[model samples]
Target: MWVTSSTDKVLTPSAIALGNFDGIHRGHQKVLQPILQASAVIGCPASARKVIRDSQCPYATVVTFNPHPQEFFTGQSKQLLTPLPEKVKLLEQLGVEQLVLLPFDRELAALSPQQFVEEILMRQLQATRISVGEDFRFGHKRAGTAEDLRAIAAKFGVEVVITSLQTCQGNESEQPTLRISSSAIRQALAEGDIDRANRMLGRAYTLMGTVVKGQQLGKTIGFPTANLQLPPTKLLPRYGVYCVKVFLEGEGENIITQSSIKGVMNIGCRPTVAGNTPTVEVHLLDWAGNLYGKTLTASLEKFLRPEQKFPSIDALKAQIAFDCDLARKILERST
Candidate 1:
């Protein structure tokens, strides 16, 4: 897939999905559906499927911003659920042909609703169609609504598709349907509701890091671990114990060495050991070897318990033993 900046040239007659798409959750997929279908039909042999006419056929494109806009406006770095590289991978998997990353700088932020549509969409991209959620907003101060986009783009003979917000049950039954969104996913992660978050994401929420040498605290207690040093801007799930799957991967993070290694992960400061710095460490069940400097991909599966202080090192060791047993049972049942 092609990744472009605002200044870069885009394919003409573009069918664009416009959004931040931070997590590329199911809701975002709904907005992208129309363009994806068009791209698919346009790419295949005409004999296989009905082909759209060249005048109507379009490049499936996504327009999103970098720096999160929030991070740009607030001048504070924000934790990211899907960083740029991950976003590119996900969009490519969904068949997006082009991704335009509008740098969220002061100049772009100053555009009004009229200029954004006429300058960015019509002039720069020459978009033939635009897709956005009903709740979507844009332009300076978020002054442009989805309806506004429809009205403005109509003058240029561009079709606008506005999708309703996608929602899912909050529980098994008798609960409200919550809208699936990036913010909602963040809330789920903050509460350690990994299962719900993954459901919304349509895939495992993977955390990647390099294994670093630690003090061997877990090894001292017969629970040897591989310490992971994560990117500072990654959005971490709540500090706690979790049932997880760890995958060994190549340095570039594209090659998987195995299916997965079941494990229990701990994320927090080691209160019992008098450690104040927060850490993420995993103990691969029934496995032991040097892992220093290796890269790992951890999939948070189930939340077992929140981080807490223990009375003694012996108490902590006992609790860890129990956690391992529970995690094994959970992983087994899940498989």
Candidate 2:
């Protein structure tokens, strides 16, 4: 996929999907499908020709804002389900051709509704058609609604597709339907409801980071761990130990190992060791390799236990050992 800044010159007309798309959850996929189909038809490659019939297609593009408009306006760091790089990777996997990451600053935030449509959507992106969720809002102070977008799009000879809000069947008996949203997913993660979050995401929740050196505390305790340094804006699950599957890949290399290793991960400030800084540390079972500087993607399988301050180092070690044993059993059963 071609990634370009929004300020870059617009060469091709596009059928764009508009949203923050933090998690690219099922609902986001529903909104993106039409745009993906339109783009696939237009830019059908030789390898994809067998799947997509020959037809004129516009550029398949995703127009999203950076720093999340909420973060920009509120001056507070907003945790994100998918960071910029991860979001780009997800879009590419979904067959998006281009990603236009618009800078969301005070200047861009001040644009009137009409100015946003005339400038960014029309002049900059040259959008032939735009797809957005029903509740999507844009322009200064979110003054523009999906209806406003449709009205403005008509004047520019652009087609606007507004998708209705999507819901998934609830797991509980009392509530039959639950809205599938990024906010809902965030709330689930915040509350350590891994199962519900994964269901809404249509995939396991994963945290990707570069392995960094730590104090080697886990190593001394006989459960060596790879310390991960995640992006500051990345959203983390509730602080605790979790059953996880770890994927390790080389730095600056496209090679990804096919098999994942079962592991136990801790996300918290190590209170037992009198540590105050929060960290993500994972110990892969039966794995032996140096992962320093490598990228590791850890997918949360289940919540094990909350982080706590053990009375002694021995007690902490014992608890971790038990956690690992349980995690292994859980993972084995799943397999």
Candidate 3:
């Protein structure tokens, strides 16, 4: 989909969806939709279809930043609901023709609202239309507003579309409408509310990582697991055991498996073993294989239980067995 962090070169005339888009949740999707419709993207992202020169045919583009503006400004490492790589894939799936991961650094952050629109939107991106949610803020010291965007873009004959915040129901139809947002999804995950978070995400939340060596404690206990080494910036759900759908992937995220394998994943420190640092490990149900050095994407399907220290290895093993059984039931029924 032509993902670039280039500050140089003007691309084709584009309709850009601008946001942090951490989780690419439903609300973010709303901002992206009008651009897709307005531009009339000619073909799939995989095809790299060039935009037609006619004034009405602008390619769909998404301009977001890395390290998150909040993280950059606060100097605090923040966990992301969808890391940059995952966010790119999701945007491509939504048929974005281009993705500008504008390097969010001191220089870029220093630009005033006027300079941002002139240099970023009008010059480099050549944006014919710009889309953002109502709450979007931009430029130095967060000085830009949706109205400001409209006023500036209008000066260059660029169209600005502001989308309203989207609210949605929880997994259960009877539940009250909940505001769709990255923070809300993070809160849901923190509260162990997987279903509500997934409902807001419009799909199962996935954790992508490479399988690395662990203490071999699970192996010794007969529940050998592939320990996942996830991105430091990735937001993990509450430390607990979960029913997961596991997929083996090749580099660049091409799926290697014919179908998802059901699994039980544990994301926590093993207090019973005197472990202190948090870790993620998954035991693929009814499967036997070495996943060392391979990449795996595990989708959280159901929350099994909160993590707690057990009395002994036997106790932990017994509980894992039950968790595995329950995961199989959930996976089978969902299938």
Candidate 4:
């Protein structure tokens, strides 16, 4: 993708879309549609695909951040819906022509709202138009509001589009649709409410990581697991064993296969084994593989059971067997 770190780089004719776009949920999609529409209407240079290029695109480019602004500002780095790489992947899938991943550092944080527009959006991107949420803020101390953005656009000879918020209630009970937020999504996951989280996310929440070598403890007990080394910045669900579907990346292909193996995933420190740190271990049923040192992406489709202490290994094994059967039933019903 066309990832430019320096804003000083000049670009071809382009419209700009701006946001953190954490989950790229339905609300984000709504915001982006009009930006693309305006780009098409402007008759700018032909849309250039940026799969592997540094050249700026002639059409729409989505500007987002790495080490999320919130993370940089408040040190609240946990509970991310999508990390930079995954967010880029999703944006590309959605047909973004170019992507600018600005590193959110102290210097970028100190620019005044007007300077941000003149420098980044106008001079740097030469943005013919800019789109963002109503709550969008910019410049040092977040002094710029949507009105400020509109004023900047008028002065800079650019158009400004402010998107409305998207909200929805669960299961047709429309008293009031819950607010779309990363915090709300995290709350749902923390409470083991995958259904509610999915409603906010518009898809299942996924955790990706490299599979690490473990002590073969699961195999010894007849339940082999793929131990994942989750990134420190990645958000984790509530501590518990869950029912999940595992997917593996294939050679020369971008598709993932859902292993037929039903499994129970534990998301916590191995208290029973006196482990120091938390681990996510999955035991696949009716399947076997040599998965050491491979990257695996696991999706928590549903919450099956809570984490608890078993008196002995034998007892733990029996409970795990039961959990697998229960997980299979839950997944079967879901399909």
List the candidate 2 regions with Cα displacement exceeding 4 Å. 46-55, 251-255
Q: What would the per-residue lDDT of candidate 2 be over residues 1-335, giving only the tens digit for each residue?
A: 77877556543677889999999998999999888877765557636743453226567788898878888878898889999878887888888878888889888999998999999988877788899999999988899999999999999888899999988777874268779999999998999989888888888899999999999999998999999999998999999999999888885454368688999999999998888889999999978888888989999999999989999989998999999999999999988
lDDT of 4 by residue, 1-335 (tens): 46676666535556688888887877787778766776444434434233222223345678877768877878875567787667777777776667787888998899998888887787778787788888888889888998899888898677788988888677653345777777778888888887788888887787778788887788888888889887776778888888877777654343346554456688988766676788888877666666666667777888877787778898988988888999888878876
The residue pairs found clashing in candidate 4 are: none
Give the CA lDDT, 0 to 100, for residue 145 in model 3. Answer: 100
Q: Evaluate candidate 1 by giving its C-alpha RMSD to the native, one decimal.
A: 3.5
Evaluation by TM-score, superior candidate among 1 and 3: 3
RMSD of each: 3.5, 2.9, 2.8, 3.6
Alpha-carbon deviation at 141 in model 4, angstroms: 1.3
Clashing pairs in 3: none
User: Model 2: how far is 309 from its true place, Å?
Assistant: 1.7
- Clashing pairs counted in every model: 0, 1, 0, 0
Clashing pairs in 1: none
lDDT of 1 at 43: 53
Backbone clashes in candidate 3 total 0
